[model samples]
Target: MKKVLIVGAHGATAQIVTARLLAETDDQLVLYLRQSRRLAQYADNARVTLVDGDVSDIEKLTAAMAGVDVVYSNIGGVDLGTQTKHLLTAMQQAHQTRLIFMSALGAHHEVPGKFGDWNEQAIHDFLPGFREAAQLLATSKLDYTEVRPAWLTNTDEIDYETTTLADGFKGTEVSRASVADFMIKVIADPSLYRRESIGLDKPGTDGDQPSWL
Candidate 1:
């Protein structure tokens, strides 16, 4: 079984990724979170190991990453780029090669329409950090797939479409579950999208602007 380490284990998207990892595979799970209380639900599971600590702490992160085959990071906010450096360092020390990171749609100015404008405006302060983190992942020696999901929604469906950074982003709002599903797929097969930034959106729902907007 693959030993998987998931940072930001307490967040909404990370929670879905955790659930999928638990239900779909026999892989050993390491959840790194700032608070242990948030992951009490997995206390009964023999396969799930919860490590309480900050992602920015290299020593703590490296210890948690021991023998891990894959790393899935879903961290955000203004310090995203800084935090990513920490993750990269820990993974490098552990000699882990595969990394699947969660980044927003506009990190590269790939999103289109009013929704894109609005999304960028809302996250203007956070983009610098995200972009910095993206640059680090792009230049790293490790195999990394930076996930850029557009204007996330809370829908139950997993239907989504994707395009490369060169092709530009399509549609607008993609469900969080869809992004999680895609991450799980990547975990199962790390060969897909190696050293690439993938943009995801719900198919045909939002053109220039999300229908809801």
Candidate 2:
């Protein structure tokens, strides 16, 4: 069984993935997040280990990387670039190479038409760090899959479409559950989508912007 390290395990999507892993696989989990107590329900679970720390803490991150086979990052913020850098450093030092990261759809400006323009104007502030993180991963030697999810929704269903970096992104919104499902797939099968970027969106939900807006 793969020992998976889920950074930012406190987040919504991460939590979904964590539950799915426990119910579906025999994998061991190391759930790392700042407020570890928030996920106290899993504290007694034999398959789960809670780690209270930030990804920026290289020392703790590297220490937690012990015996980890795959690292799935579900955190994003203004300091994403710095966090990504630290994660890469820790992984390298620990001799870990596989990573599954959640990036933005516009990180590479791969979205098309007016929707793309609207997206750029909407979340412009968050793009730089995501873009920078993407570039850093592109240059790194690790086997990483950058998931660029479209506008997010709280929907419980897992319905989505995917596009590559070379193709234009599709749809306007994708459920967090969908993204979580895809990440679980990668964690279960590391060879799937190795060293590529994937754009995730709900099929037929295309528009000038997300439906919620």
Candidate 3:
């Protein structure tokens, strides 16, 4: 079975991914988070091994990288760029090549509508870090798939559509559960998407795409 490491595994989206992974795969699971308290909810899950630490800390991340076959990073903040850089460095040193990262739409380019406007603002405020992070991942030797979802909702539905760098999807919004499902899919089939960023949203929606574009 594949051994997988999930960074930011305690977040809402990450929690779904964690549950699905345990239920669906025999893969050994490792969860890395900044706070040990956040992982308390998962203490009883036999499939999950927890590591409490910061993803941006090289030494800590490197230690977590050991014995891990794939790294699924859900870690995100205003300083996404720096955190991504640190992850890339740790993966390089560990020689772990499979990676799946969560990013928002309109990260590098703009979406088409009002939601797009919001996304653009987020990018303006956060893209420097996100762009740099993407650059670091792109330049790395690791096989990667970056999943960018539009506005996130709490719906548990799995209906969604995925596009790769296409335009005009300005009002699309995807449920966080759907995003988690997609992440799990990428982890299972790394060959399906590699070194590419993809856009995700609900299958049918209206008006100025979701904020992520």
Candidate 4:
């Protein structure tokens, strides 16, 4: 069975992805989180091996990468660039490939659609890190797929679409559940592997900006 390590596995999206993997696949899952208490709710999931550690710590991250077939990173922050750098270094040291990174929609340039201003600001502020992370992933021999979602909602729906960077989708938002589903789908099908990044959004949704944006 494939061994998958999910960073930020305590987050909402990670939790859903964990559940789906446990139910649908025979793969082993290693849930990596900074705080062990965050996984209390899932204490009974025998298929899950919880590791309390920080993604930015190379030693800890490398330990978590042992025998991992797929690494799904959903960790984000203002200092995400630093985090990604460490992650890349650890993965490289471990000689592990197959990565799925969850990044924001406006990671490259500013789009004038929904959440444009805030997203632009965020990208501008964090672009250096995001770009660096993308560069490391793109240059690596690893099979990587960067999934960028517009606004994230907590709705319990699985309706969404994947679009290229030039799709010019305006004000599109997707549920966290859908994002998790998309991650699982891509992981299950190696053919879906795309080195390029893609945008995700809910169908028929307007106002693409997230409240926090």
Better of 2 and 3 by lDDT: 2
- Local accuracy of candidate 1 as per-residue lDDT tens digits, 107-146: 8988767767877887899999989998898889989999
Report the error of model 1 at residue 206, Å: 2.6
Off by over 4 Å in 3: 166-170, 209-213
What is the alpha-carbon lDDT for the whole of candidate 3? 0.81
The alpha-carbon deviation from the true structure for residue 135 of candidate 4, after best TM-score superposition, in angstroms, is 3.3
| lDDT to native, each model | 0.89, 0.93, 0.81, 0.80
Q: How well does each candidate superpose onto the true structure, as a TM-score?
A: 0.95, 0.98, 0.90, 0.88
At residue 158, what lDDT does model 4 achieve?
A: 90
RMSD of each: 1.3, 0.8, 2.5, 2.5
Give the candidate number with the greatest TM-score.
Answer: 2
Clash count for candidate 1 is 0
Runs in model 2 deviating more than 4 A are none
The numbered model that scores best in lDDT is 2
Q: How close is candidate 2 to the true structure, as a TM-score?
A: 0.98
- Write model 2 residue lDDT over 51-138, tens digit each, in one string: 9998889999999999999999987998889999999999999999999998988999899999999998888899999999999999
| Best of the two (3, 4) by lDDT | 3
Q: Judged by lDDT against the true structure, how good is candidate 4?
A: 0.80
